[model samples]
Target: MPALAVFTATAATGTMRPTIATAVAIVLAATSGIAVLWSTRVGAGVGPDRAALGVLAVACAMGAVASGVQAARIHTLAAHPLTELTGGRTGVQLLVTGFDRPIRSGGVMVPVRVEVTGSGTSARAAQLDVVLLARDGWRGLPPGTRVETSVAVLEPRSAGDPPALRALTAPRVTGLPGWTGRAPAAVRERLRQVSGRALKGEAVGLLPSFVLGDEGRIASETREEFRAAGLSHLAAVSGANTTYVVGAVLLAAAAVRVGRRGRIVVAGLALAGFVAVVGPEPAVLRAAGTGAIGLAALGAHRTGRPLAALAAVVLLIALLDPTTATGAGFVLSVSATAALVLVARPVAQRIRRPWMPGPVADALAVCIVAHVATLPVLVASGLGSGPWALPANIAVAPAVPLVTVLGTSAAALGPVWESGAVVLAAACSPALWWLDTVAGVVAGLPGSPAVTPG
Candidate 1:
C-alpha cells in the first residue's frame, strides 16, 4: 500500500519514470494474483473444477478492480490544480503543514496547504505547496503551527542551481515569502526550557534529539559528524530507535518478574508515550504501527507477517492523510523495517562461511538484506549506486545498537541526573568519533552519489 502511495504520488507529478513504474506495479500485482490461483489448483491435486475456477476468477477480478480504483484516485488527486501551480507568480494563503530543521541552504523551508484567497476568488479548495523563506524572524515557527504568507510560487528547480529555486512542488515546498503566525505560547516556553537544558553538553544535546526528536540543540559539528558516518538515523525517531527504547523498558519490567500480561500492558503504555514524545509525524506513526503489529505477533507466538502489517499500516495512514502518499521519508521508513523483518534472516542463513564467526555472519546477513531491499530506492533517488553500501553498513551496524540504547537512556535521564548524563556522553564520544570517520571516508570515496532532484 505504501509503495502504491509512492507510485500514485509520482504519477500525479506527471513524471514519466514514476508513471511507468506505477504501470509496472499494477501489471505485476495482476500477474501475481493469477499465479497464486494457478499454483493452488495445480498443487492441491484438484482439477480446476467449475466452482473453483469461478472462485479464482472472481478473486482475480476483484484484485484488479481494487488496483484500478486506487490508481484512479491517485491520478485524480495528482491532477488537482494545486499540485501544478509550481513555476509562476501567484498569491496564496497557506496553512502551514510542517517545518524541517534548516539545511545547508542557510534557511528553513516549510510545507503548507494553500487555498487561493486572493483576487482569483473562485472559492475553490486546492492544496498549494508553499515555502516560507526563514531569514531572521521566520526561524521560529514549529511544526503543526499555521503560517499565513504572501509569496511567489515557482517551479521545481534542480539541486545544482544557484540559490536553488525555493518554490513549491507536489511533495516538498521550495520558495515563498515571509510568514506570520501567533504560535502557542506554552509550546514555545516548553521548547525554550528543553533547549536550554540540552545546551549544557554533548549528552544533553543528544538527549533532546532522542527523547523529543528535537535536534536543534545538537552542535552543528556533531550533527555533521553523525551524517558523515551514516549514523544520523539514530537521531531520528525511527523504528530501530523506538525498538531499542521499548526493549529496554520491557527487559526492566521482566527482570522484576512482571507477568506476560503485565509486560504487554507496560509495553503498550511505553509505546504510546514514545509516540507522543516523538511527535505524530508520518514516519514515527508508521514505525509505531509496525512495532505494535510485531509485538502482537510475538505475544501470539505467530511467525509474524511483516509485509501484511506494513500494508495495513500504509492503508490506515493513507486513508487518514492522503498527502503522506507523497512523502519520501514515509516510503523509506516502511521499506527499511520491512527489509529488516522479511529479508534479514534468509540472507544471514545463506552467508555461512568457514572464516566468519557466528556474530559476524549475522551482521553481514542483515546488512546484505537491508541494502538489497533499499537498493532500488537508493538508485531511484540518485544516491550512490555502488554495492559498497552493504559492507559499510555491516562495519557500522554493531555500533548502532549501542549508540541508540545509551543515547536514549541519556536523553530520558538527563533531566534528573546530570552526572549520569555526563558519563553517557563520555561513553558516546568514542562511538561518535568512529561514526564520523566512517561516514567521511565512505562519502569521500570516488563515485559516491549525492542527493539529486527527483
Candidate 2:
C-alpha cells in the first residue's frame, strides 16, 4: 500500500518490510525445490501423470516463494524525504517509470527516482516519489529513462490528492533507456502502424487491443458495444489470451523437432516477449506467471494441472504485488480462469450433441464457464449484463484464437516486414469483421434486461 509503481518485468518500486519474510521465503523455496527433485524419482508408486503433477505443484510453490523474496527486497525508505519540502521548490533528477498516473494536461504522474541535485541532500536515489510531470514529452518517457528538472513539492490538498512534484521549469531528458525499453515500444508501435494500414475502421483499434492489450485506440462507443455484448474482456489482454499465445508458440517450437529443454527455452523466451509486448498489467502479469510455470514444467519434461498453476500464479502475483491481491481485475481474471479449468471439459462433454464437433463443444463450454464466472464481477460495477451476453460470446468465441494467434504473428512480423505483417494480418479480417458485427447486433437486440448483483 506504500507508494508503488509496478513494472512489466520482474520488478516493482515500493516500500515494504523485509528481512524475516525474505528469509522465510528462501527457506520455503529451497524446500519446494527439493520436493520438485524428489517428485522426479521413480518407484514412488505414484502414476507418471500424478508424479508430474506433483513436480509441477512443487515448482510453482518454489516460483512463488522466489517472488516473495524479490518483493521483500523492495526496501522501504526510512524517512519521508519530502515532508519538509512541501510548498517549496527543489532540484531533482527523476525517471518516468510508468503511466501510473495521468495528468490533466496530457502529462502523467511518473514515479520519480529521486537523485538529489539540490541543497537538500537527504534524499536517496534508491527511493521513489510519486510526482506530477506536466511537461511536454514527459509522458512518453518509457521505463528506465531519466528526467531532470526543478520541481515545486506540493502537499496533498485533499485525501485523493497524491503528493505532486509539479515541474517548476521545462524538464529535460538527461538519459535514455537501451533495448530494455526501446524494443518493446518499437514492436508495439510497429504493430499499431501495421494495424492502422492493414485493418479498417474498428478493427484497426481492436486488433492491437486484442493481440497486445493496448486499448488506447478503441473508441468509447466501440468499448460500450463490446461491454453490452459481454465481450469487454476481449478488449484488454486476459489470462486466456496470454495462455493461448504461449500455447501457440509452444506448438510452433515443437513443430521443428525442438527437444524438451530447447522447447522450454523457446516457450520461456516467447512468454517473456509476449509479456513485454502486452505491457505488464495485473491480469497479464498473473497469466504470465502461470504461463512461465507451464513452460518451466515443459522444460522439466513434466506436466502440471492448470488449476494448480492458476492457484500458484495467483499466489505468486499477490506476493509480488500485494496491492493487487484484492483488485477487481485480479479477482475477475482468476474467477474466469478457474471456471474454465474446473468445468470447461466436463461441461463440454455434457453439452456435445451427436452432430456437434468435440472442439466446438469444448470451445462453447469454455465460453459458458468464463461468462458465468465473470458475470457477477461485470454487473457488480453496474455494467448491467443479460442473457444476450452468452450467445454474443458464443458468436465471437471462435474468432478469438484466430485473432490472437494471427494477430500476434502479424505484430511480430510488423517490425521486420511491414508488407509481410499486413499480409499476415489480412487473415484476421474475417474474425475482426465478425467481432464488430456481433457486438453491433447484440448491442441492438431487444430485451437485454439489466442483472444486478444481489
Candidate 3:
C-alpha cells in the first residue's frame, strides 16, 4: 500500500519523460511484481493472496508512469517553440476536436483541441491547444469541425490554462465536419428540437444537457444556479447516469419475461447504444467501465472489492491513454466512484432508522459519502465549500432515476415515434420540475456555495 502511495504520488505530479529512467523503472516494477508472485505459494491465504495484491499494486504503478509519459508525448505543444510565434502573427489551420467550458464571468472563450498546419515555412503537423474566441464563426461548432484562421499566438498566462496558443483575431471555419462527426451533430440538433417542443422555460435549455451532456444551450444564470446547488455533476454523463440506463433496460427485459441471460444481453445492447450516442470520450468510457463492472458483480452475485475494481480501471485506462492522469475531471471521477464503492454501504447501514425507508437511507448515504469524499478534490480544484449540497442532493435524489429513465426513453423514441416520445417526456416532466425546484431554492440562499480562493 505504501508502494501504491509512491506510485500515485509520482503519477499525479510527475512530468512525462521518454528516457532510460522510465524504462528502468518499469522493468524493475515488473520484475518485483513477478518475483513476489513466484515466491509466495498459490492459494496461500483463505482470502486474497497477499502476493497477488502486491503484484497488482506494482503493475498499476508501472502502468501509471507509462501512461503519463505517453500522454506527454501526445501533447506536442509542451515542446512547441513558443518563441517562434510569440511576437508575430501566423496563418494557422486548426481542426477543431472539442470545446472547453466557457468561464462563468460572461466571456466566450472556447478551448479547442486542434491539429495545427501552419502556412508557408511554419507548415508542419502537430496537435496543439488553441483557445478560440467564440464569435460569429467560432461559436456553436460541433467537435470534428475544421477551422482555419490567421492570428497572433500568445504564451499561456497560467499553469492551469488549457490552450497553449490564444488567437487574438476572429477565426473563419474553412471546412465543415466530417461525415462521422455529422451523426453527433445531427443528434444534438434533434435534442434541441425535442427539448424546445416538449419542455418550457429553463427545462427546455437544461433537458438536453441533463440527458446528452450538451451544455451549449444552457443559460449562464442556470449554470450558476446548478453550480451553487452542487448539482453540476448531473450535466455530465457519469456512472450514475449509466447505472440508471442499464437499470431501465433490465426492467424492460424483466417485464417481457426474459430470462437472466436474455436480460444480460439486453443490458449489453443498451450499454453499447448508450456509448455510441454519448461518444467514446474518456469520461463516457470510464462511466461504461464502472457500469460494466457493476453489472459483472451483480450477475455473479458477489461483492467484489471496489478499490481493486477502481485500480484495474485506472491501470487499463492509463495504458490506453496516459493523458487522463493529468485531467481534474478524471481525478474527481475516480475519487467519487471509489467513495461510492467503499463508503456508501457502511454509511447507509449506520444512518438507517426504523422510520426511514431502506432506499431513502441508501440514497442519502451515497449523497453524503460522495460529497465528503470529493470535498478535498473540489476544494483543491477551487470549487470551494458547498455547505447546502447535502440537502440539495437528497431532495433531488429520487428525481434522478426518473429523469434519466424517462428522458432516455423519450430520446430513444423521439426519432422513431413522435407520439411515444411525447408521452415519455410527459412522464419525465415532473421529475425535471422537482430537480429544478431544488436547485433554484438551494442556489437562492444568502452566500455562494463556491468559496473564494485564498
Best by TM-score: 3
List the lowest-lDDT window of 10 residues for candidate 3: 294-303
Tens digits of per-residue lDDT for model 2, 1-454? 0111111112221232355445545655676676666666745576555566565556546544544644444434223455446788877777665433343234445555565535445543444446565655554455667767878888764322235687877768888876666766677788888988888989988898788766656676776677767777786666667666777777787898888789768777877777777655445667676445433332332333665676666655655555454356776776776676666667888999999997688668878887888888777856547569889998988899889988888877888889999987878988999999998788778865432211
lDDT of each residue in 1-454, candidate 1, tens digit only: 3445434533343333334435744764676577567755674556555456555544444344344444544564456554454454444555555545555556556545565533355435665444455444455454555444445545444311111124332322233323222222222234435435444446545544544456655666666544444445556666756665676678789999999889878888888766554555556667777666544432343336656776667665554444454355566666666776665556666887888786667656655665676667655764424434565676777666566666655544455565665566556656555555565576556654442211
87: Cα error in model 2, Å: 11
Q: How does model 3 score by TM-score?
A: 0.81
- What overall lDDT, based on C-alpha atoms, would model 2 receive against the true structure? 0.65
- Give the distance in Å from residue 61's predicted Cα in candidate 3 to where it truly belongs: 6.7
Residue runs of model 1 more than 4 Å from their true location after superposition: 1-85, 115-135, 156-235, 293-305, 317-328, 345-368, 385-388, 409-427, 445-454
- Model 2 clash tally, residue pairs: 0
Q: Could you estimate the TM-score for every candidate?
A: 0.67, 0.66, 0.81
Compared with the true structure, what per-residue lDDT tens digits does model 3 show for residues 1-454?
4324433634543453444335545665676566566556456556567766676656555644554455455344456543356656676777665533455654356656556656678676666555655434566666676777766666555442333555556677778877555665666667677777788888877777787777777877777788888898889888777777897788789998999999989998999877766655556778888766544533342346656776777765555544554466766777777777766777888999999998778768767886787778888887654678778888888888788877776776776677777777767778888888888888877665642211
**Candidate 1 minimal-lDDT segment of 10 residues:** 158-167
Give me the runs in candidate 3 sitting further than 4 Å from their true place.
1-77, 81-89, 99-101, 107-111, 129-133, 151-154, 157-162, 167-171, 294-301, 305-307, 349-358, 450-454
